[model samples]
Target: MKRNKFWLLGTLILTVTFILSACGNQNSSNSSNKQVLTVATSAEMATLSTTKYSDTTSLEALQNTFEGLYRFNSQNKPVLAGASKVSISSNKKVYTFTLRKNARWSNGDPVTAKDYVFAWRKMVDPTAASPNSQRFESIKNGVAIASGKMASTKLGIKALGTYKLQITLESPISYFSELMTGAPFYPQDEKIVKKYGNQYGTTAKKTVFNGPFVVTNWNGTNLKWNYVKNKKYWDKKAIKLQKVNVQVIKDASTAANLYKTNKLDYAMLTTDYIKQYQKTSGFHSKTIPLIGYMSFNTHRKTTANIHFRKAIAMAFNKESLVKNVLHTGSTLNGIVPKNFAYNTTTGDDYRKDAGNMLTYNLKEAKKQWAEARKELGKRKISIELLTSDTTDSKQIGEYLQSQLETNLPGLSVSLRSIPLKSRLAATTDYDFDIVYGTWQPDYADPVNFISDGGQYHLDDDYNNRNFRNLLNEAATKYATNPTKRWSTLIKAEKQLIKTDAFTAPVYQGGTAYLLKNKVKGLQLSPYGTVLFYRNVSIK
Candidate 1:
C-alpha cells in the first residue's frame, strides 16, 4: 500500500528481550562523557539497502545513516539536508537543487549530484527489483524506466555541475517535497556500490553513512548495533547523542524489565505496562500512520464468493480487536485510518468522510454465510490464517482464529506462524487464505494509501477497472484539483475496500512507549521514518 515500510507489530514485545549486553562492541576505553541511549526494538533489520525491502526496521536504521536532499524536521515538515537551496519552475514540473559544500559522507567523500543520479538509475533498473522503484513514477519517464520501456539513462534526473541537481516531473504533485524525504530518494555512492556489488549495505563495514550517525558493531547478522555520531556530518553540532545502542528484544516483558532496571533508556509498552508506568515519568502514546488490515486471497473458492467475503469481514468485532486485544489504538473505520491524512479542500479528517464501512454483527454475518453456502452448496469451509512468527503476531493470530471460528459457525480457521520473511513470501505469493497486513504512508497524502503499490496488491482475478481508472485519474487528470482528486481517490478506496471488500480494516496503529524523562530531542514523526535520534540527548 504505502512504503514507509516500517512493520508495526500486532502484539507488544511485552516480555521478550534477547540478551545483547555482552554482544555490544562499545569498548571499555570509550569516552566516559559521551551520552549513550539504549533502546529496544522488537525486530532485527532485514537489510540496510534503501531500495530493497520496504520494511520498517530497515527504514528506521536508514533514517539515521543517510541524508536525502530533504528530511522531515521535528515538526514533520520537509527541510533541506544535502541541498542548501532549491528552486521550482512556475508549472512545478522542474526542480533545481544546489548541494551544500560541506555535505560529506562518513568516509569524507563529497556528496555530489552524480550520487543521486547513480542511486536513481540503480533503483529503476529492472534487474534491481527494488520495491521502491515505482515511487519515482511521478517523475518524467520514471514509469517507463521502471517498466523496462525506457533505458535508465533516459530518466529525467540531470546534473549540471558537481553540486547542482535538476529533476523533471511528469506533472505537478503537491507533495513532491515530502516525497524527497523518503528512503528510496536518498543519494548513494556509485564507487562504493560497485565495489561492494551484491554485498553493499549487507554489513556496517560494507555501508557508508552521511547522516547524523555512522552505524558500527553490526556484522550483518547480529541484533545488536550502535550508532556512533558522525564527526564528518555537516550538522554534527546539532547532534547531541554521541552513541545510540539498539537491541532487538522480542519479549515485551523483557523490554519492560530492562526499562525498569535502567538497562534500556526506552522501551515500547504493552497494555499491562501502560497502566504500570502511567504515573512513573516518561509514558507517551504516539499516534502513527500505520493501518492494520486482514487481506483475503480471492483465489480460494470459498473466499471468492462475495457473500462469503462479506460474512467473514463482518463476523469479527473490530471494537474488541482494538480495545480488548490491542488496548492501545483505535478501531479503524476504513482502509485509511484517522488523523493519517486530511481532505485538501475541507481540511477535515478523511476517515470522518469515509465513515465506518466495517461493522460487527453476528446475525448479519450468519445470514450472509447462509446465502454464500446456498450459492456454493456447502455448509462449512476451512481455511488457514497466516501471520508472522513473532510473539505479538502469533497472539493476534490466535485471537483472530478464536474469534472468527467462534462467531461464524461451520467455518474453520487454522493458524500458521512463520518467520517474517516467510510470512511476506506467503502473502505475496498468495499462498494464504487470509493474512495479517500493514501499510504506512511514504508521504503526507491519502493517495499513498489508496494507490495500488507495495503490499496492497489484492488478487488479480477480482478486477475493478473503474476503481483503477479512478486512481489513475486522481494521480494525473485531477492531480491539481485537490477537491476532485480527494473525492476521486475516496471513491476508489470505497470501491476497493468497502464495496468490493478486497481488504478488511481492523485497527489504527499507535505506539505506546516508556522512556526516561531525561531523554529529549527524539522526534516521533507521523511521516517518513518512525523515530529520529539525531538531536536526541540526555538531560
Candidate 2:
C-alpha cells in the first residue's frame, strides 16, 4: 500500500480544538509514578480499518492496537505475537499457524482462526475496494478473486478448527515471514465487522483490539486519541506503558514547546528546529528507506509527452532541495534508497548496482523542452502541480515551480496545495498534470518499492510492456534465484525511471526527532510502522 505523509498546516487549529475537547486531562497522571507516555504526531490517522486505511499514521495506530500472527521486534525482526506456532509444507507453499490459546480480544472473546480468514478474504474481495488488494496477489487464487474472476471464498486461506489456520500461496515468497508483520495480514473479528458494517473502524468504540493497546477517544475525525493497555492481551505483562496519549501537532515550533514543557514524551523536529535541538539531550536522527518523488499523469496533454516528462525530471535540483530546504533527507540517484536491498551474492547495495538515473542539468532540460514544444506544436504550455498542504510539501512545490518555470522556456507551472485527503483523491482521479508522492516499502525488499511504488498505479496511461515483463519475470521465473531476480529488478527500475521517465526520483527520507530521557525501549523501524510502541516504557 502507498503511504503518504499527512502533515497539513491548516489542520493545526482543528487538532487543538479536538485536544481541548478531549474528556478530562489524561496527561495529568504523575509521570514519576504512572507508566503513561505522551507523544505528538505530525498527522491524524485516517481510519482504524486495516482493509481500507492507506496512510502511515493510521498504519502505526493499527500496529499498536491490533496483533497480527507476527510482529516486528525492537531489532526489526519478525517475532511471534498472536500465533503460537507455525508449520510449513514440504513444497513451501502451504503455511499452518496455531493461534495462542490465551489470545483474546478486549471483549474477552478468544481470537480464532476464523478472524484471520475473514480479514484476508475481505481484503482481497473485489467488492471490498481495498487499495491494498494487490498486496495479496501471492496468495492462491488471490489474483482471480481480486479481479472478480473467482469468488472470494475460493481464496487459499482456511481455518482448520478454532485454533489452527492454513494459508496456501501460489508461489514461494522470500519475505513471506517478514510480510506477515504488516497490518494487512492482521485478523479482524467477523462478528464485530458484520455488526458495524461501514462504521466498524470509524470510531474507537466500534473497533476491537487484541494487541498490546486498545484505542480510545477517537471519534473518526478527531485529532486526539488514547492507547490504553489491553488487559486481555496474551502478553500484557510485557507491556510496560499503561496508557499512551497522542495528539496531532503539525507545527514544529508547537511540538518543540510541548517537548520543553514536559507535555510530550516524543516529538519530531522540522528542518528549521533540527539545528536548535541538535546538541540537546535525547536528540536522534536516522535515514529510513522512504523514497519521495513526483508522479506525472501520462494521460494529460503536455505531461503525456516523454520529452516533456524528461525535461521536468532534470529541471529540479534535488541536492539543493534536500540540503538547503529539507535538511533531513538524502538526494537519490535511483528509485531505490541507499543502504537498502543489497545483493546477496556480491553484498552490493541496489542503489550502487543500479547507478544514477536522475540528474540535474539545466542544459539537458532546455534541450528536452525544445523537442517537446516542437513535437506538440505549441509555444507555451501550462501545467498544474498538485501537492499536500503540509509545510514541507509546500516548500517542495514552490521550489519545483520556480525551477521548472525558469529552466524550461515555454513552460508555466501552477501550484495546487490541498489537504492530504483531498490531494490523494485528486491524484487517484488523475486530476493534475503532476503530483508529489512518497512511498515507503512494506518490507525489506526491492520488489516492494519497484512494484508498489509506481509500476502498477502511477499513471493511468503510462504502460511499458518491457518494464512490466521484467518485474513479472523477476517475481515468478526467478523467484528462487536471488542473483537473477536482483539483476532483473535493477533492469526494471532503470526501465521505469531512466528509459521511460515515468516518474522523477526525489530524495530518500531521514527522520530527526526528540525523545524524552524517561521513554525507553522504543523501537524505530524502516518498514511498516516506523515507531513501535509495544516495547516502550516510561522510566
Among all candidates shown, the one with the greatest TM-score: 2
Q: In candidate 1, what are the lDDT values of residues 430-531, reduced to their tens digit?
A: 688877755567787776666532333431344689987887788789988988988887898888777877777767766677666556677765642267
Candidate 2 Cα deviation (angstroms), residue 236: 1.3
User: What ranges in model 1 sit over 4 Å off?
Assistant: 1-33, 298-306, 371-378, 452-463
Candidate 1 local accuracy as lDDT? Answer: 0.74
Tens digit per residue, CA lDDT, model 2, 127-167: 78776676787789986787789999999999998999999
- lDDT score for residue 292 of model 1: 73
Q: What is the C-alpha RMSD of each candidate to the true structure, in Å?
A: 3.7, 4.0
Pairs in clash, predicted candidate 2: none
| Model 1 TM-score, 2 decimals | 0.89
